[model samples]
Target: MVNKLEVAWTLATVALIAGVAAYSTVLLYHLDALPAHPDEYVDVIGHQWFWEFCYPQNVSKVGCFNATYDPTTGATTGGHLWAAPGSVVQVNITAADVIHSFNIPGLGIRLDAIPGRVNSIAFTVPQVAAGTSFLIQCTEFCGTYHGTMRADLVVT
Candidate 1:
C-alpha cells in the first residue's frame, strides 16, 4: 500500500502543516510584542454613535474634542489623531455606553472598545509623505449613524 504516490502525498502534507505552523508562530509573536515607550498616549472614548478623542500627553494644554477631519487637505480639525512620522502612538480604547471597536485599516489596528474596561494598542506612524491621511472607523455595529462614525489620522 505504501506506493511512491502515497509517500509523495504524505511528505507534501507534512510540509504544508509545518509551513503553516511556522507562519502562525511568527504572527503571534509580533502581535504580543510591546513597542517602545509611546510618544503620545491618546484616550479614545466611544459613544453610542460617535467617537471622542483626548490627547492626555500634551504638556501645555490637553486637547479633547469630537473627531472631525478634512477630506481635501488631510487635516484633522478637531480631536482627531495627529502624530509625527515614525512616532509611536498608543491608544487607550474604551466605550461609555455600549460595545464598540476602534480600527485603523492602514495600521493593522483593531481592538475592542469595551464598557468599563480599557483596551490599548500601539502603532508607529509610518514614514508617509506630507499630507498623507488614513481613515479609521468602527467595525462593530452599535446603532444608527454608525456608518458615519469615522475619523482621520493625519501624518504631519
Candidate 2:
C-alpha cells in the first residue's frame, strides 16, 4: 500500500549521492599525488614571525636563508624563495614552533605548516619576466608578530 512514486524518488536520490561520493574520493586521491620529478625542491620552515627557506640541492654554499620583513618599508630582506620561470617547484613545508599556513594568493597556493610534520606541495612557476615576484603570507594565527610574517617568491 506504499506509494510507488515515493519509492522511485528515494532510490534516485540515493544513487546520486553514491555517485558523488565515489567521484570525490577519486579526485582527492589524485590531487594529493606528487609528481615523479620536479625542476626544483625547496624546504620551507615556518617560524613564529618569519619564514626560513632552504635549497638543499645547491651544493656551492650554505643554501639556508631567513626572510625578515620590514613593516615600515614594506620590504623583505635577507632571503627570498626563488624559482625559475615555467619550472615545476616542490616545497616541503614544516613549522619550528607552532602551526602555520603558508599561502600565495596570486597563484592560489596554500598549505599548512605543522610542527614536526612535513607537508609537500608542487606547482609550476608562471612564465613571467625575470625578477617577477609574488607575495607570500601566513594565513594562520601564529603569534603577536604573525601579521608581519611575510616573504617573496621571486622568479629567477
Candidate 3:
C-alpha cells in the first residue's frame, strides 16, 4: 500500500501548481491586450545613436522629428516623445538599423525595436506637472554609440 502522507502532499503540490498556471495565463492575456482607444499615438524609430518620433495625427505638417543627445549639457534637441499628462499614449516602435530596446525605467516600460517589424505598447502618462520628463534609453547593445542613445518623454 502507498503512504497516505505522500499522496496528500503530491495532491497539494499539483493543486498549487494548477492555481499558479491559471493565474499566470490570465495575467499574460491582460498584459498583452491593447487599449481600444489611446489619446495619442507616436511612432518611435530607433537608429544607431538617436531616436526619431513621428506623430501621424498632427493637423499641421507631418510631425517627424529626430532627437540628438548632448552628453556635456545633458540636453536633447530636435524632438522628444511628447504626451499629455494622464493621457493614454501608444507607441509603435521599430528599428531603422539594428535591434534596439526602448526602455523607460521610471515607468517600467521596455520593448524591443526590431527592424521591419513594428511592436506597439500603450501606457497612461502620469498626472505630473507639465514639462516633466522621463528618460528613455536603449537597453540593447546596438553599436559603438549605443550607450549615448537616449531621449526624453516630456509631458505636454
Candidate 4:
C-alpha cells in the first residue's frame, strides 16, 4: 500500500507540472490577453531616413502595394492618418535596406520588417481617445540613424 501511494503521488506531481506548463504556453500566445479593443488598424513603415504610418485602413487592401509620394516634399500619396476604434487593422511592414522593428507599447503591437521579406501584425484598439497617439520606435539595430526611427500613432 505505501509503495502504491508513493507511485500515485509521483504521477500527480508530474501531471501538475505538465498542466502548469501547458497553461503558460497558451497564455504566452493568446491574443485575447491584449488590452486593445478587438478591432483597430495599425501600421508602421520603415525607410532609410524616416518612418511612415498608415492609419486603420482596410486590411484586405494592404500588402506590397506601390505608394506614390511628392517628389520634392516627400509626402505619401494617401497621407498619414489616425487609427479608429472598432476596426480590424492589419499592418504590412517591410524594410528598404536593413531590418527594422515596429513597436507600439500602448496597443501591444510589434513586428520586424526584413529586407527581402514582409511581415505583418494585426490588432484592434478597444477604445481610443480623440487626441491620443502612441509612440513608434525601432526595435532593431539598423544604423546610426536607428535612434531617430520614431513616429507618432494617433488614435482618433
lDDT values for all models: 0.83, 0.94, 0.94, 0.64
TM-score of 3: 0.95
Q: Of the candidates shown, which would achieve the greatest TM-score relative to the real structure?
A: 3
> TM-score of predicted model 1?
0.75
Candidate 2 lDDT over 1-156, as tens digits, reads 999999999999999999999999999999888888998889999998899999998664258899999999999999899999999989999999999999999999999999999999999999999999999999999999999999999999
TM-score of candidate 2 on Cα atoms, chains taken together? 0.94
Q: How displaced is residue 112 in candidate 4, in Å?
A: 1.8
Residue 131 accuracy (lDDT) in model 4: 65
Ranking by lDDT: 2, 3, 1, 4
User: Candidate 4 residues 3-52, lDDT tens each?
Assistant: 99899999999999999999989987785344454354445567764566
Q: Residue 82, candidate 2: how far off, in angstroms?
A: 0.4
lDDT of predicted model 2: 0.94
Backbone clash pairs for candidate 1 read: none
User: Where does model 1 exceed 4 Å of error?
Assistant: 1-29, 68-77
- For residues 51-101, could you state the per-residue lDDT of candidate 3 as single tens digits? 999999766427789999999998988889988899999999999989999
Off by over 4 Å in 3: none
The 10-residue segment with the lowest total lDDT in model 1: 68-77
- By TM-score: ranked, best first: 3, 2, 1, 4
RMSD of model 3 against the true structure = 1.2
